[model samples]
Target: MATPTVEKFLLEVSRVLRERNGPQLQDILVIEPPLPPLYNLMVNELRNAFPSGQDDALEDKCTRALPEYVEMEDGSSWTAFIKFMRQYFCFLRDVNVENLVETFQLLRNLVKQSVNALGHGSMGVVLLPTVIAFSRALTKLTIALHKKPQLIAHLIRRQAADESGSRSTLVDTAADVLRDAFSGCLNDRSVTGAGVGSDGRPMGKKISIYVIANLCLKLYFECDKIRSAEQIFVNIQNGSPPLSLYPASQRVTYLYYLGRYYFVNNHFYRAQLALQSAYDGCHSKCVQQRSRILPFLITACMTLGRFPSQALLRRPEAAGLAEKFLPICRAISRGDLATFRSFFGPEGPHTDYFLRRRLLLPLRDRCEVLVWRSMARKTFLLAGSQGDPGARKAPTFDLHDLLRLTQVLERRSFGQTQKKPIGKTHTNSIFMFQNSQQNGIKPELYVDPDVKGVAEPAGPPEPTMLDIESMVSSLIYQGFLGGFISHRQLRFAIRGAKEKGSLNAGFPNVWEVIKSRSSDAVPGWKRDEVSSVRNGVSRPPGPGMVIHLSGARPAGTPPM
Candidate 1:
């Protein structure tokens, strides 16, 4: 039964070819072919039957042949189908220059309907292949329409869908078709200068390049290949006619995407530079757009460890802008917890939401702020005890305090004393100074009666009394003269040493006699016979006074 049906179909196709006026030609050619060989034969027969000199009929015949072959399920059939369509479309392209406008219009309409059907979930296995065929056909049509402004406008209208409606899926499907078409055209390099310019000359559509780049970027970003998106941006930048060749607004848009790509990849330095350029390139008239750009700029600055420009921060025009970003800077500097929390809040258009939530906010609030606050407290304590007389008595900063603080701030469960003591050398210096003051002593006053009697010849006997209290007071006074110690503490140290007699006992009797003789202007006390007289005594020296009685000095003392 299938063989006879196929035979009857073949006979009808042959009859149409001979008569060339069959009303059912379109219907007959569009019927499903039976097998791979029969499919190829039918396609070849249709191709040969395309009317000569009648370009419209030839295109219609080829167009009608598309739906038939595109329905095949087998891979071989699909491949052959694609090959047949490509050859047929290329033939239409070459021969039907005048009739190309109407041919593309009809083809675009057919594919658009197919696209809509596929989007509505009407087509199942056939959808993918249909998309591929529609894409190929659209590419030829779009290229043909490039020379016809009326046709170009018509195609655009046909392609337009309700952008704000549930048309994204449709747009996406159409975008897929457009993407494949552009890819094919780019591969062949034949689409260049294929479109007609307003000047009525063939020119490449500059807008298409931007559209292609944007599509590629979107595709790559959705796939999470941020690096490839960045590379595409680089290519866009280094193109022969640079991205800057576009108008400022378009250029700004390009830079905007380029900057975001860098930002997403953590290329902060490049991101900052690119975003700054974009922000500046966009005019002030676009306040909303400027607002959108500001956060990215702020983030870029922060990541690069740079502060925002003063102009931006201080400008009255940027009031809301300052409110948005200044807290981020302050939080970073002071390690403030509340500010950090607000920075990562769920309200704004933050780019690195996950990082802020998972890492930066928690780290700052839970760890960094606590660590810095502890350090500040330690510094204040150290500064408070700068100078104390009994430095060892002063409480020193502790290493364990710092280490324990560190553990607490970092949320770690460890408490061990630090190996090195805090301010060790400084504490030691203070201790040594204290010990030296304790060991120091004062000199005693001594007077010799022998020298006192012989000093009558002088106008006045020089005072030989040593004021030990005064001498010790001078030393202690000098030590604490800086007003670091209270007067009561100074007096107590002096009085304590004197009461112990350590101050007076430090002087020797012989040294006292020498001092007394020197007071009386006696030249040599050691050589004088008074020294022998004093040495002869075995008993303890008298408490009141002792005079050395030398015979020669006694006779001439008054006279001398």
Candidate 2:
């Protein structure tokens, strides 16, 4: 049954292996010219075989003769293993799973035979090189198939959608195949443990993990497997050398995928830190990747009331975000709600992206802060101007007027966002929520034993200086409006001179704000009890609608 051409090749290889040392072993195999090639091919025939493509058939035919060559009196297992692997990679697409299984089995037999002949020293020296080559082949195979899992998903959804069989079946099959292969290989951490391979090198878990991470980087954008991928990263995070010890590109990609997972889950601080690390580690030549990460990075910073540094903003990769958000940034700093609305309106160009990313709610909160600060400034000016000319105490800005001011600012702010269909509903919902605050006698921060229970007003209690002051207190605590509320009057002023620079910088300079307040009221700093909820989060009472404060939380609880 043997082909005459293959019979000649096997006879030559067996003869050379019998007489050869390392140089002759290297040369006859034609591994490289400076090394020996003891038995690969006649020079003319080797020249005719070509480098790749159909030449894989020629290589496969030659490799099938490997065991025949090894069975010859003096032929060795090392030559058969190397020859089989070279042919396998060369004809990778055509190789079946059974053939692959046979190959690893051959590897085990070959390595153990080498260990017996060369003694224990050969276990490390001989098997180490073989292990390295085996790893590279698996890595190469993994890289080749890396996109298949996602490709299968897309094909099912797009090309097979609506078919009677159901596209999900194909998708599930593809996911199952990849999941089993990747998980099994990566989970086996003890590569060199005695019983692992039984006869040879166990599959190296390190290379498998790196390879799977590469696939996950691609899969992350392709499907909903992020949670699984995140867990994989976590489980392997403490591996011997650590994932950080992987190639730089793999580490950067892992951080990016990890950061995106955290971002979607609303862990802003961790997301910010992870994204920043990814951005820092990004290669200089990878401009598009750097550009892709900028928007999420910008939004994460904004949610925490901060901005990326000017140096970071100046990069060409960040130009688009800087152009779109700079106006809102400046508006926030100036406490100019009108301009913030102009740039940040729901119908503005980037609105859908922000909403999809769940950043719109936080942006809306910042807008309220700007509007509330303006309202506070107006209240301060009115207090200075009105009431008795020689009055010892400043006249209170009427609760009615402040309520009306909030309505006007809210209307204008929402009006800008009203172009989109959902924008109208969002505006109406916020308006109704704020109006409810004015229709009741809300609890004040007062701890008076005499005022044991809230008095039920005959009708909704008209907004008072106490109610107004409570709204201000809530805003201060939430880090929305930077300045402190007056304990005596409901007046809101810009924070002390030193912190004026960072007032609307997004992050509240809390220590400065608290330091400016008198020490007397610090112990039981009054907190407004928010009675309203929208979409599950509590909102402060009155027009400016700050975020909720828990039951009687101390004012000092705000972080510096």
Candidate 3:
């Protein structure tokens, strides 16, 4: 049977709605079935409208189509379809299983139409509703996925699922198709074209890219398709119009999702930078949105092996969440695995929330590493406390103790219920965790030291000496642990360093505002008000990372 077109289907819908108000109308009958076909038809129209490889023809086609859109369709059916679309597309209406697939297809089609129907920049303002629609869809869909894994199967069949349960790549679908459409059109914007704006950008192009990127990220994050999201972001970052052209809100949102993508992949430093950008630009009105970014921001720091220097979480507004994280911060800093587990375990306030987003494990790595590194640190400290004035802190950690430590960390930190040691000692004595795809610790167990816990080298009449050196190497490489491993002595040297001479960039204004009329009851050297003001002003302060984006200051910046 041939599928009916939405325009033809809308004739009946208009009649039904005309009789009874839309409130009583079944969404399935009026809004769902015809949508997929409409989307396909619109895409076909866009493919024909926005031709590729012909710069001259592309411009001519866009100009010609502008007039057609203004006067092309029947007033009754198409208008109603688009009006209902405006509501559904902008997330003003509800969508159910019957219509969800069609809704995504509709969103993709709307973008395709918007991208191709370019004219004056201001005229393109209507395109933003499509982005808003997409944002809501992605948020809802991602949440739904936790409840319904196959939610988007009707619209985009995920071929990523396999016997080995890991999502590596998504099957080619609407997201990729939209990407191709956008890429093909972007190919035609002349580098030196007259469309360049007062801000030295191509008119009508930057805003479209801004809107499109936000949607692309939702596909990656919400749709559970990592490679597609990465592809879209890389494309934008490398060559597309500058994202900064978008408003602060859009920029913040894009960077936030981008940061999350980076976070999951163990790219903590880059994730920190992107998330920091989001947090910095976040305004007071969007506290809920800002709150969403906060836990991830803190996660980025923990992964990097430290708590942020700034009192970000201690702010009056942020204290609620920060108070909970404070225990975690102290636990990880001191390498207290027992306490760390209690703070982030099942009953912890933030654990379940962060776990829902797949963020807690990333946070746990640093804690694991901290526990192991702290052991090594104590070994060095104990040795250094010997009678010799020049005694270096050295690893005297016993072989069985190391094994016991590793076993406990594996079970506790990883939720690894497997009651066995992960590896045997090599002849060179390097302790390597067996890369078990079965256990899914191939990366987190060995390559990533921040993932936590230590694998110890067990010695025997067996040719292998304990391989403590290799395990320590991995930890130091990722910045989770400090000092080098001594292969000759078969010990991990513990050299603890501190961030001495660090200046607090976030508190300069607070110091300036301090109107201390003598010290309030504290015994102190009472300095003149003028002297205090001069000291505060003469500190040679520098600009810090944007507000709320607390991290170690970039190196080579003069101390504030």
Candidate 4:
């Protein structure tokens, strides 16, 4: 005999089954316990019925709500979903919440069952909502696992499902399950069902690819398994529809991860493109989302010599970012190496901030090159011969002149700190100033700027002649300087200064130089021209070019 509460639950399930209401059915069959009185009622019913072996009677009523087989096509999805829900009920009743590892595996198998149904006739429409729900459950499982760091060792061992002979973590295995789900959506063959839309795009279940993909990416990044994320990007570029067809939320999330992938591989140009699109497409009201995108976007922009403006830093999303990046900008602009190193060095105040984002070494290395260019340009402007037509000569500056300017900047940047310590303890200044103040007299101190003829200071060593030459050569080689180093004269001279003026002939714009060398196409980014069919092959979308082989060897030749 069924209890009144058990009978009422079964009646509701039957009603949902008859009306084909997936969301309501999903709500009823949640793996976790329901809220408030329902939770207490379900727990009490399970506790009282299980020990007496009367639970089988209640289970029978749950089973009878949906029959084993339905002759009608409309009942197929319903039948599949109800079967999954019954398993959810069993898990909720029996699962040990304390053992999250075991609990995660149970939920994983349940979601895997849902993943399998994604391929059955038209069941994807019915099971996808549950699939996303279970996946979130798995996410919570991983988060819980992260809190217990000691238990991570247990997760580090290879599971029976992983055949690669390498260890896996809780998040890694969850990503694999989600990858399988993503594949089910990507590989759907149904025409009118969930495969392609009327506009010739991935529709229905296929639209869930990015949703599942974003989940997998989140896990992969957390577990330090970035290489695995690349394969997902490749699959989307090959088969998925243009990203614009998806909702704004999905597009923003996918592009953010894609931009980060490019960034880790040192592809700043591509990183900037993806991140810029993500930032622009994101909703203006989503402050947290915009905040997450700005760090990588700012780093990429700075690498390409485009600094963020003051107005941009004043936005709510950019709070505290100015303190970390502003010093670097001012250092680059003023060509101050000491200030740059003082703020961003290994022992600097902002070191931990940049280190956490993995931006420390890259910013330190790549931005230093721009600093050299600034120093060189400043030296030329101050000392190089002016390109007045009356002079009729190329603009030239001595290497010694640049060396002097660099030393002056370094000394000034570090001078105050070097003198502060000694002044705090020294006798002459403190005694003399205190006596004069007691007598109501003011003391004035002045020193000539040209007093120091030697390069002695309490900081980094001065740049040598060889270092200056190498920096100039590098700038010239990279096309930042439209000039050549005159080794014999130990000077840098612009090629067409007499005709085009010094600034035009000697220094090129940093953005233009970097832009000309960068490729326009980023592999996973979507554009207007990409086709649904992609001409029967998967290739990067953009203008195609050919490579010429030099010194080709004949086929099957064995000699070296």
Candidate 5:
């Protein structure tokens, strides 16, 4: 009952499998939505012959219609491929109708059979290319389903009861599919040695781990289920070989997500390490990706008190970022509390941008301490009397001086965000009633004692001495300041001014303090390991190879 074209296609698939041709099998099993002409023709033939209203009958129909189907041969080993192919055809038919419920079900089966093909001996390894192709198709469909929330709800309702009775999205289901594939690749025992594949090229199905993982990570993040991605990192770190063995693009992307994960968990130092590696390894031509990374990188550096340079801000990838970050950086450097609040506060121009990126709250909280440290530094410079160089007592500034500065900055900050009355200009409103009352006379303005007696509405509580004291004490405790506060005298004195210079002793460098407290190694980042074998040969660099150039002149150095 098979059409001539369908029969020829099935026979060609069987021939490719028999020959163990991975690339050919991949082409024959193309499964991205809107199937290829060959696949479309096959599905159309099957639909005409055996139509199922809403059931899984492709197998039954194939069994009856094509009894000579190649997989039906006794002792045949192409079972998984045939199953995956049928499911893929069904998926393409249903996808056009937007039958998400049915399409997801088919996707689940396709993932299962693909993973099975990976586990089935050397033949499975030959199918690795096909598995990768299927994974690409899977990632697209999964992400597409995730973007439509209404379909997720509909799929949930029409599907069977859940064991956990909790809600789930199609992307989460796809993650399980991808995770199974990832585990299959991770546990691939066919690797001849560490980081080397079976066919002797530093390659194998294990090379597919990050490919699947990066896809799964994409889904988790898109679904706002980032915490669920922790196991992916844990598994790779505990068992997978050095990440440098992988391609650079994969390393950059994985590190990017890893950095973002650290950022969300409040590990700013670790976040900087991961993001810095990602940004450096990323190709210069990848402008959009580098741009995606810069905001987080820039923010992380700012948290550690290292501001972006003019050259960095001028990079093509950093376009529009200067408008967003430069003002805050200037405020932090200049101790301009009013400017900081105007830009980061609720009425700030970039508030929407910051909030959209989830940066508003963290920036407001963390960088305020840096601002206070700057303010304290400025206060010492302006008001403190530098005692004699040989004086035993350290240089000190009165708390009252800091208090006055704090009050002025706080009031100025409050004034910048004040809202004016909605409708009238001052002159138009103050004289409008006069013109209406006396046709053409300009009414003399008089102050009303009753109105004056009513106190003006209070602004933000002026920064009190207690607030300033507590803030200075915090800066000292956090190691941003190398000083201590005196309770009785209400003054802050540098601890080592007699031995170390006043400026050096009073304010410790922010980056150095942070770096000292953190470990040097970053989890899941591999920088040194290199693969020893490729394609069954040991190919070390030749002696004359221009590998390391320690003697090379640095950029911008004048040549002698």
Candidate 6:
């Protein structure tokens, strides 16, 4: 009783649906009238062709009718239709009552057709919706059939290889696709009727998460975009506490990527926390996964300045983590190259050479302490030009020499060893002092150092008491004092100073100066001012002046 045009359209749609050629179905169904009967007939044919065993046929009829009013001429309309077919295919794929896997090849053809339509720009208006739909359907199919991850991974890689436009534009398109797919999975709530689960939870949630995680990682690798991955992870972390997932292995995988995301962003503190949690969640027997994550965990700990356990440090598994990284301390110490190379495996020689060339060599030259030593060596060479061979001491500014000095100093001051290289700026200042001593520069030790004499021909003098006070005042003027120093830091520095006399002797004073200036309450600075004045004038402060200032202050005012 149907018109020939109607029958011909029905036959083509039937062929596409039977073939599971969703893309072809999309093309044939693009121009259909918004008629309930037409939709109902199509639904009847599909259901009869692929039956769900306890079906109220009317439910299919109503579900199919919902797509009738959706237009396909505009992007929004096309998006909607794509969404519909996506869900439709997902429902077909997941319905346990049906044998959809046998028909998946046919469905793949339609998926291919839809992709081709998108490429041709005929489906531009609905490209996003179509993408979302296809992803949802693909996710459902994978979950229902227990498909391997490589299949989806291959599809994503192929799409990324298109090479069609500016790099930024291509990345943006890929990002949009991932974003839409993520949105679809989060919004989908039709699990019960689709036979996915009885509790209205889609069987696809885990698979969806897996696919999105891999896709996000691919996006990060290919395009270097991370926001999508970050959002997906944040959502997962906030939506459910990971421990609730029975197969903790899958959840740990998510945590791995989450930690990696933070690590790549240079958020080592957070990366350490997340990676540690992942390691804790894994079974004790899963040594391979633990081996895979150990290096990242160690790197995070190193970056955060946390000392890793000796067990982790000595484990053969730790070699992978230590191998590529050239820790500043280790490189400076010139630890065993063979040990270092063992981490890089067969590429050890090449990697070791590059590491020495690019990092160790440049670092040695630019680092301040070494710079001071080099200058001292030059000065000693020049001084000997007048023929005083007996006056020369062996050059004593090697890495071991510095390490021994730092260890001794740290032990005397802090009662504990520092576990990492000190900042280059601070280390350089100490090196200069050592070089001055070695070169017989006779650095004047005075109670009140003169400020002007501190200036070198090379550059301005290091900061004096007055200069530090003024700098603090400037920072306070800009309202940056509160941000730079906290009350606790001030207390710690003060406590540290009382235990070690003349805290002003080293870089610790720099921290103190910044702290005192930023504090709401001022600090006593008689010693600092006296040291500065004495150094600048190359003379000692008389006892009478100290007594006069001590007597001049009011009851509670700090001496300055």
Top model by TM-score, which number? 5
What clash count does candidate 6 reach? 23
Ranking by TM-score: 5, 4, 3, 2, 6, 1
- What TM-score, computed on C-alpha atoms, does each candidate reach? 0.34, 0.49, 0.52, 0.77, 0.80, 0.36
Instruction: Name the weakest run of 10 consecutive residues (lDDT summed) in model 3.
Output: 500-509
Per-residue lDDT tens digits of candidate 5, residues 1-560? 65666567666766786687988888777666566677777777767764656334665543433344334445555555556556655655555436765666776777777787678645667778877777766777777777786777756775557666666566777788888888888888776555565543346677777877888788788778899989998888766766777889988999999888888777888898999989999988999999998999888888888889889999999999998999999899889998898887666889889988877776777898899999988999999867666656778888899899889998998888776333344566654573443645434544466796677668877888899989998888888999888889998988888777888889989988889888967675544443455678976874223465777898999988
| Most lDDT-accurate candidate | 5
Clashes of 3: 8
lDDT for each residue of candidate 1 in 1-560, tens digit (9 for 90 to 100): 02233345545544553453323444433321233555555445444554345445544443454444445444222323233333333343333335666555445445444333333111222333443444555554454344345645654565575464443322234345454433332232322332334654322323234545554454444434456554454443333233444457755666666776766656555666677888998887777777666667676655433557668876543555566556666654453433344445443234255363223443333333332432323432443223233442322233334334333433321111222342334445543443323435321323455685454442222222132223233323433111122234322121222333322321112223323333331110111112323557655543223556674564446865
Backbone steric clashes in candidate 4, count: 0
lDDT of 3 by residue, 1-560 (tens): 22234334445444543453322333423332335555555434434443333334433332332333334444312222333333332321233345555455455454444334322222223333433344344445434443464665632344443556554322234455456444533443533343346775445444355455665666566666665577666666545545555578877887888788777777666677788878988886787888888878887766655465447775544647666667777765455565676555655557766678777787666556666556445444444222222453332334334445545544564442223453353565244444445365554434565644656544222212354455556556755454455566555443432221101110111112222221232111111122222535753333221234486688888878
Better of 1 and 3 by TM-score: 3
Superpose all Cα atoms of candidate 1 onto the true structure and report the RMSD in Å to 1 decimal.
39.8
Q: Would you list the C-alpha lDDT of every candidate in the order shown?
A: 0.42, 0.50, 0.50, 0.76, 0.77, 0.42
Off by over 4 Å in 5: 53-78, 97-102, 151-164, 197-202, 420-457, 526-560
RMSD of each: 39.8, 18.8, 16.2, 11.5, 12.0, 22.9
Q: Regarding TM-score, does 3 or 4 come out ahead?
A: 4
